[model samples]
Target: MVTVTAAVTEASSELIARARAGDDEAFQALTEPYRRELHVYCYRMLGSVQDAEDALQETMLAAWQGLAAFEQRASLRTWLYRIATNRCLNTRRTAARRPATQWSVPGVEPPEPTRLGEVAWLEPYPDSLLDEAADAPPGPEARYEQSESVSLAFVTALQLLPPRQVAVLVLRDVLGFPAREVAAMLDATVESVNSALKRARAALRRRPPRAQHEPAPPAGSAAEDAIVAKFVNAYESADLDALVALLTDDVFISMPPMPFEYEGLSAARDFCALFLGTGREYVLVPTRANGQPAFGLYLRADGVCRATSLLAITLAGNRVCALSRFDGSVLPRFGLPQSLPDGP
Candidate 1:
């Protein structure tokens, strides 16, 4: 039998050639490398993980069907991106805005320290993938840097803009696409593109100043470990008082898909006491999201176990200013098991 390595190499080479020659399967192979990243891009655009997945699938199908019309004028990667962006834009036109969940699923709720409208649409992407993307291959000049683009704050801020603005900001600022190329992708004039970018920047600038971010926690950092432990314990125990202590005086919290957010320690504390950790019991299964610390917050409903939601936290100077809970369905994406050990 041929070795697996040899098979993969041979298959990749054959696919690339065949795809160039109009073979759909070959095109699929050539585009597979971009699928995950494109999905992430779409997700960031839509602010709904479900919408991103749908857009990605549609983009792939469109690329496959449109291969015959593709010219070599642009790199295959760029061509794929153009298809994905158009797909997301089209989806955005018809997609309904899902109200943010106050508490995930029946009875399993985490502390809701904020209202949905105060912050931008907040969702979680697998931390593992974000980390992987941080080290992924970059082109000759590394036009776009993934290091901070995938952060919770960054992604949250992105959703506050209109879809076109989202696309323009991400392409020009995050992905570093040239204005000319961005115009072509959006089918707008360069002047129009420039105006959109200006507006996007202005909108972002008008928002309150965000706290500084530390890239990734050091492996053996006692500070982070302790904070995480205390956070998890306070949350799992439903101890509102202890939980409040971990927060900074001006900490903020927001949940997207819902229009609730909270600012300041007092507001956050009220939310935890009134909505979450009041009648709910939680078990935090450690996980990662948006290249930062995170967890799968499972809840005990009556006497049965069920998944609640995924929590992604952003830390600043040893305190958490932002804590977001993405929908529970996102668990699988981060490779987290659906169930966890029952509490003692």
Candidate 2:
């Protein structure tokens, strides 16, 4: 890793020099490597993939315009973050806070939610994007693993923090930057940075656990395959008992853009009873989301299969624990078709 880092730095130094000398291609080269991680970081701060990409584009443009003034006091990564953080902060200041996801299904009434979830505007991050970003080693000061930080629950908890605190916590804890460096990026003193992180940590602690301790097996591991197969079998068969049997006792369910939250096996059963009880069969197209097992669910009705739902499942001790259900609005991001043939 050290050797690779040195080579990258060497390459970036050359590009930086050429870019400062007015080479557009060199400037692009200098900024490209940082884009994805920056995007993930922005996503973490803003809780929206689209928002993150927009901020990243703006950050690149800002970096380009400011390249001439680059003192190189901080690594390019840190400098880019400074710009992106400010951009997100500005965005949050003007944009209305995201509302909880609403239940939009017609005719099928879900059981009354036992409690309202705080992060209704939460969205799932694609595991494919994490392919490169999460695998990169967390910086020395980073307390949380990169992949772990992007968990829906963690990102949701992050959205609840003040934007500045969000930046501070991500920089200090997720990226592993020291307080002094985060202080520099945020244009604040170390003390202020530390203070913000402290508050953020306390607030995060008050939220429900976003994940269990069991290590998520590799994306296509046998264990993951088994659990996913079980889900598909139970769901497609519309066997409520078999379906409920697959869930852990404390299983959690949330549909983003809606505030409703259901927990435990009984609530899971209620959800299954409504979504699967339709006499028509459902089809499960295997997929991935937020580094967890996910599926694109479709229902066979009216001679065609149409999008019914998307589920991102969290695991604990080999049993499904947290099941995050998303409305069809998310299907496009996963490259899932809106409809499919009822036949295999």
Candidate 3:
């Protein structure tokens, strides 16, 4: 086993060397590891999956053409990030951003939920991908830096930041790049990076405090699983009483890009009861969001799939403390298919 592990490590090292030497296949192997994360970074920066993918391809092309100029100054990972971040910012400058939609897809009809609150721009991410473990190690700062950046709220909030501030904060805070390195990436001084980070932190603090959920479910305890099961049943059933029973009295729920947010269980319950399960029946296709159990909710309208929403419930201990409903158009970012299996 030890010998086999060493061989794999040596092979990966060889691939990196060859890639650095301008071998396409070797470079492909070397770059593959960073693709998903880089794409994710672009998505956060641009707030569009299509744009992020385009930027990812552009970053690779640039990296390949400039491989000869690659000095061993920074790790290959950081170099790629520098390239990807620049691409995203450039795209942001030129790209035409479509207004966000809260419903599932372009063609799908939507059910009447209370007055829509400018949530059309908010989108859903697949729960499956959010459940996947991140490749990067937990950075030096143990808190506020985790895979949760993949969450819709975190990403949406990031989009609200200035483009440069977005890159600086993400590189320094999310990806754990040092201040000096971030400065180099942005072609700015360390002091500038510090200033940007300060403003970014201040802006973020003003937003609703999001719960930092655990990445992986607790092992074999059944605590989180039980909670998730109860949530699924309560939500799909539209049983407001059962749902409120599982929540704390002071539980809060908010959807970003929309001004409407609810505080307290009664208000939340009333909102859900009135808005959800009113005219259409809902089928929750289970997925993960915000590093917690989430559902890809499909609302049937006229016996056809109409609307989809991504729901991530934040639990405090075993009680649901917050529930965030995001629009479904962004599910592709999470690799969730547009159509779910029928009646599963």
Candidate achieving the largest TM-score: 2
lDDT of 1: 0.73
Instruction: Extract clashing residue pairs from model 2.
Output: 100-257, 100-258, 101-257, 101-258, 102-257, 102-258, 141-176, 142-176
- Report the C-alpha lDDT of model 1 over 37-97, residue by residue, as the tens digit: 7878897887666778789889988887787687657766788889999888876677666
Better by lDDT, candidate 3 or 2: 2
lDDT of 2 at 161: 88
Model 1 alpha-carbon drift over 4 Å, by segment: 1-17, 20-24, 99-122, 131-147, 210-222, 274-280, 300-305, 341-344
**Residue 335 shift from truth in candidate 2, angstroms:** 2.1
Worst 10 residues of 2 by lDDT: 208-217
TM-score per prediction, in order, is: 0.81, 0.92, 0.76
Question: Candidate 3 lDDT, tens digit per residue, 1-344?
Answer: 99998897788678767877768999888788788778777877876567777899999999998887877588778899899989988876676656643443334333333343433344444445333423577457423555567655577688777788888878878778888888888888999989999899898889856456434455234998888888878776778788789887777676544545677766777767765546546777666654567666777665455446667776667887777776666555565566654443
